[model samples]
Target: MSAALPQVFPHAGLPARVTVYEVGARDGLQNEKATVPTAVKAQFIDRLAEAGATVVEATSFVHPKWVPQLADAEDLFTGLRRRDGVRYPVLVPNPRGYERALACGAREIAVFASATETFARRNLNTSVEGALAEIEAVVARARAAGLWVRGYVSMCFGDPWQGPVDPAAVAAVVERLLSAGCQEISLGDTIGTATPGHVRALIDTLGSRGVDPARLAVHFHDTYGQALANTLAALLAGITTVDASAGGLGGCPFAKSATGNLATEDLVWMLDGLGVYTGIDLPALVETSRWMAGHLGRPAPSRAVQALTKD
Candidate 1:
């Protein structure tokens, strides 16, 4: 049998130090109605780094018609003040997107695939197998170019169009991603419909398949107000990395009723209060979230910000 995972992760007992990948600048702002200026995006990155995000997803190289807000991804990456140890990863949808990211000096990149056939067809316009074949080429090329790659398996917990997703199906895509050389795989709760029970079962099942918990991460949207609870489940499953958006800024545009992602400020606050070192400055994080909210003509969606700002 695989080595027994620590009954109580000392890291957790001593307050786990989770790595939070800030996806606000890219994932959060992508679906916005207003076009967030490239200069604004650059400043946002600077502030996110200052607030202690070691890895910030800066932008996507998706087509303009799909996400016009981030059409100037090249400009956004080019304008950022590059920090020595901090990573600025961008989402590259295909080979063309990968080429654009390389031109802009992207040191790390992310690609996405879905678990359900319906989502694969609807989101990527291909079957699950076809999409994986294409992603294999992309990942191979990216690795050859010496770029760090991350894989996203969306709708892992459940799908709106396809109903309940199979754990075996989730594991199959994860295996493809890992085999294709993605250093880390992030399982996404795309529609925000997952419960803590589902999160636990999926992690355990993936573990049984020999997927190291260390290389796995969770991305949950708080649509049903269960993101934090699901995060706790991930910790129990020995996952230390998570994907959160500053100010809870994004949702699936296809799922109109969906809510924004789990708020970074909120997640950091909980981690900090528990003595978990997220390496993020909570006050500065709140300020950045509020700044983005103001820029978008919306209010910050983080409860921690509301509570902290109220006093």
Candidate 2:
């Protein structure tokens, strides 16, 4: 029997294809309370790729003292049976982390930055300016090594400590990342307080700052059920890349209020209905998520996964 599919209704003004930057491996598993086995992590990445995800964030090289869940970064990255035509980008916190990724033979890497000072202090243990300064050096070195670098700007829409964030402040951080030789930037709604208007406004603000929307991506948390809505706003604003976790399985360990990331299944389902090509096999993706959830000993949080898997 064939799996169920959403009926296609072509949407005007939407891109022909969207790149789903799958973060289930690094971002998703990083927040887990239990340590997932290294082999399981490798299999998870391979399954996501088999399900047609071209850009899967493999793992982070942060110190185990910070994110202990991903302590096996080197082991996992070394044993990964990389697929053809798929890009696995790992997170590198600083120069030392970049060195680890480089030694692991990482071809692509991402650096994290924060827009708000409070969260920067808590998450990165530095001020916003200090974080940018450190990330600038890391990004420059990665680019010099011919590695594709992605910059992640967190707290773009809102911050728990600071409340509503100024879009202009977010743009400043983005401008620095672009200046630092980052190939792309993923704006993070870390607290999930963003509305559709706020999402569009931030992207517009970046555009006015001479940052092209083409070089941007959106990373939304679904704490308030607004991830999909904010994503729609970004898509309409000509942003194509989106960061999502399989089975909706990630939250910021540093930010207690932050919740699970926008689910890959949910995003794919919506894009499928809108006739936006993602090249993903929905049933295969769901099965992969379900498999991972079994390892986590919980049901998948994705609405599409729950509904479609009901017997």
Candidate 3:
């Protein structure tokens, strides 16, 4: 990305700047069936940072049996060329994972919980309260270790088994994470069933409970092709942080109906057209995702990347 250029949007009540949290290295790649070499993952991180990603989710500290792809979290963090302004956060399932991440010199990390009881049972063989308790323990230790912690509430909009989820249910986990020392909470539409109206309702639920939208982030999937639309709703609702994956590379291992996340390229295209500053170079991101798609033996799923790469 080049020097920051001033931006002025003709639209009213929109933020001038937005933060794109890159999740390609962790949430994106962890769902791949094939193993991506640690070196490739590390290089992916390097390119994302060079492409002007300020916050990149590097890896996870889950057990190898659970998420074999990110089992080498320690090695990946060690080999990474740490950027001065970039933040690399790892995902930890419990205090054990947090301990491993802390030992690896991790400065920031994230813990995930679910809003649906079925998802919690299927994903972790536990209840929502059980998962929340686990993450709370990890967050406590992470805070005491002087590390910044983020929390994720998956299946926020709707669940396949249980159908539409209550906004208050999502807010319960969000508040729990915040009370457990999470500085930011990412609400995820795991199966991509969310629309602009649903996004607003969820944000309103939180806002009514005194949860500031500024400390919230939205992670939407593109299964039904509504990720960007939902993101725009989030932005208009006063959310400044958006989570995306490079090349549209992500799915949930636990959620069978999951799909790739909102592509960073796709989000950047919309934001750029709106005269919003994201400090990201579109061309660079396309080239990087193109390279990644080649390595993964698949075409990049990002509409912007495909449109830009085609002659």
Candidate 4:
């Protein structure tokens, strides 16, 4: 085992450090039952920056009817404090979303699509192929405008309506996203049902398909309480980027019982304890999550950090 990893970590020090993309402001807030005010979003983003999160997803520029919580994407993007070194990525569903993001001075953007045909039709009002065609155009436009593009493949592990996604299907979508010029692609467990074994298998499949492991990211939700285990599996498989939300802010609207994204505070706590350098200030991150939870009239679900700091 390498000196950088704690003894407790499985496959300690094998995969090295990972880049954590913070998505509390966008994906975390998009599914909220109550629309969070723009000011609160800006403050939340500023606090995330103070906690050493470099890649913060700011908001989505989708149609208001689809995700009403992010209806003020334009104002929210412009109102936030734009730091020098940190990146603010906004989700753009189509060419129109990309253009709107551009108008708000967005330098980076994210595009998303579901792997299942049913989800594609329900979520995007189109088929998988149709959604991919739109996303391809969005990617080209964003790249031409000198923007960083991140592709998101939802339901990588499983879907509510579609059970047990095929690894081949996941690989195909990943290939298309990479071919369309997305610098990185994040595979999402939209329903949070992934296990460690499944994570390893999917990564292996993607790797075998000529997908560069370095450009792959894992976005896991903690609904089944297996996110951390799956994250460990991804790290062992050479995935370097992970997506997490601070405070575990969002839940699955499709599956009401599901919780939210893996909390940043919890991930950082584990990484720090394992001697992994995430470049995060644990105390500051916990404070941010606590504050957000309080503001939302709830408690944070970050068991690690909450327990560590509550004393």
Q: What TM-score does model 3 achieve against the real structure?
A: 0.96
Put the candidates in TM-score order, highest first: 2, 3, 1, 4
Q: Whose TM-score is greatest here?
A: 2
- Per-residue error (Å), model 3, residue 269: 0.6
- Per-residue alpha-carbon lDDT of model 1 for 50-95, expressed as tens digits? 9899999999999888888888988888888988779999999888
Question: After TM-score superposition, what is the CA distance of residue 168 in candidate 3 from its true location, in Å?
Answer: 0.7
Model 4: lDDT to the true structure: 0.85
Candidate 1 residue 213 C-alpha distance from true site, Å: 0.5
What range of 10 consecutive residues in model 1 has the weakest lDDT sum? Answer: 1-10
Please identify model 3 stretches exceeding 4 Å from their true place: 1-9
Predict model 1's lDDT versus the native: 0.87
* lDDT for 240 (candidate 1): 89
Predictions in order: lDDT:
0.87, 0.95, 0.91, 0.85
Which tens-of-lDDT digit does each residue in 170-281 have in candidate 3?
9989999999999999999999999999999999999999999999999999989999999999999999999999999999988889999999998988888788889999
- Tens digits of per-residue lDDT for model 2 on 170-256? 999999999999999999999899999999999999898889999999999999999999999999999999999999999999999
Q: How do the predictions measure up, each by TM-score?
A: 0.95, 0.99, 0.96, 0.94
